[model samples]
Target: MKISIITVCYNSATTIEKTILSVASQTYVNIEYIIVDGNSKDNTLEILKKHENKISKWISEPDKGLYDAMNKGVAMATGDLIGILNSDDTFHSNTVIEDIVNFHKKNDIEASVGNIVQHRENGKIVRLYSSKYWTPEKLTIGFMPPHPSIFFKAALFNKFGNYDLGFKIGADYELITRFFLRNKIVWEYSGITTTAMLVGGLSSSGTSSYKLITKEIQKALAMNGIAFSSFKIKMRFFWKIIGFLKK
Candidate 1:
């Protein structure tokens, strides 16, 4: 199946080149590379222009935010499958996309995801989060596959809808929960590593991270039609700390 990889960026001149090269180097030939930039003031647009020949489609203009940029990319995607790679992230290796496509084809899966390595700004690998074979119960306790490592059938978007622009930091989390938990989309868990994501991303940084996570948990619980208690939320945070420690 043809796949479209979207990279949404803004003022990411220092790192956008690596993201572009990662997608361009993919071994999968039937891939579409689309970049949506939010009118960056930095050299991000210049870098994109330099690689314009490799990009299937690119646009640089002001956008509502990251999710809005992603929505724009989704609207433009014409491939059978869609995946997103953030400007600060890269595929684990050149063959990653090829492997994902092969696995999906062989297994007849609607979605596929693998492991992700979280790395430092200087490209030092920090932690690895693996995608467990998914189950509805796992989502209740906050287990989620890394968003960048996920590839889903594009038609799923038509049924479940796109990322909710109403969410600032937790839109992706909400989307995943809505699909995997509420809508019960079929997915395959590839045991291979897919991407290396930069640590300290918006959802994992600063005091606001806590606020956004709280909102995410609420969103997930509401979708699952379950009531959440403060104690359970605290325990979930405790388990998250434990997961980090294990890393």
Candidate 2:
């Protein structure tokens, strides 16, 4: 099965090349690598050109936001399965794509979720984000599999729709909850660490950002008609602390 991986970025030159090389080194052959740049002002564009041969398709243009750029990348994809890799993340291993494909085929599932190692810029591991502990019911508590480690059959997007542009930090959480909870897409854990994510990204920042995302998660649940309590949502941070200790 062909897999399409999309990396979305803006002024991400500091770590974009590692992300590019990670995908380019994947053992899976029938893969398409697409990058959507939000008209970066840095050398990100130059780096893209330097590794142009590794990219199947790429576009440099202004976008509404992160989710908007992701939507553009999805529109450009032609592979049967699609996954998004953040600009600051890299595959845990060269065989990650191959492993994900095998897991999906073996289980006969339309989507797959794996684990991720969130690490600092100095390459210090922070926590292990695993799908084995995730469930659709956990959405009420603002929990989700690491976005970089989830892959879905492209058709699922056609059925459920793209990320809601209304959210800034929680769109990934919102969309995943929508698919796994509301639409009930079939998904299984791949039992592989798919991505090594940098510790600081859109959703991985500090306290103020966490508060904003918590509010957005609540909004997402309400929008989906899912019954949730603010207390349950706040408990997600407790689980997050557990994740760090487990790591």
Clashing pairs in 1: none
Can you list the residue pairs that collide in candidate 2? none
Q: Write the per-residue lDDT of candidate 2 for residues 1-247, one digit (tens) a residue.
A: 9999999999999999999999989989999999999999999999999999999999999999999999999999999999999998899999999998888888978888889998888999978878897889989988888888899999988888998899988899889988999888888888899999888788767999989999999999999989998997887878778876996
- What is each predicted model's overall lDDT from 0 to 1? 0.85, 0.91
Candidate 1: regions farther than 4 A off: 223-230, 241-247
> Per-residue lDDT of 1-247 in model 1, one digit per residue for the tens?
7899999999999899999999889888999999999999999988998999889999999999999999999999999989999999999999998998888888877788778999998779988878765455566766668888889899999888898888878788778888887878888788879889988787888767876687677776686575556456546768878766886
Among all candidates shown, the one with the greatest lDDT: 2
What is the alpha-carbon lDDT of model 2 when measured against the actual structure? 0.91
Q: Show where candidate 2 strays beyond 4 Å.
A: 239-247
Alpha-carbon RMSD of each model: 1.9, 1.6
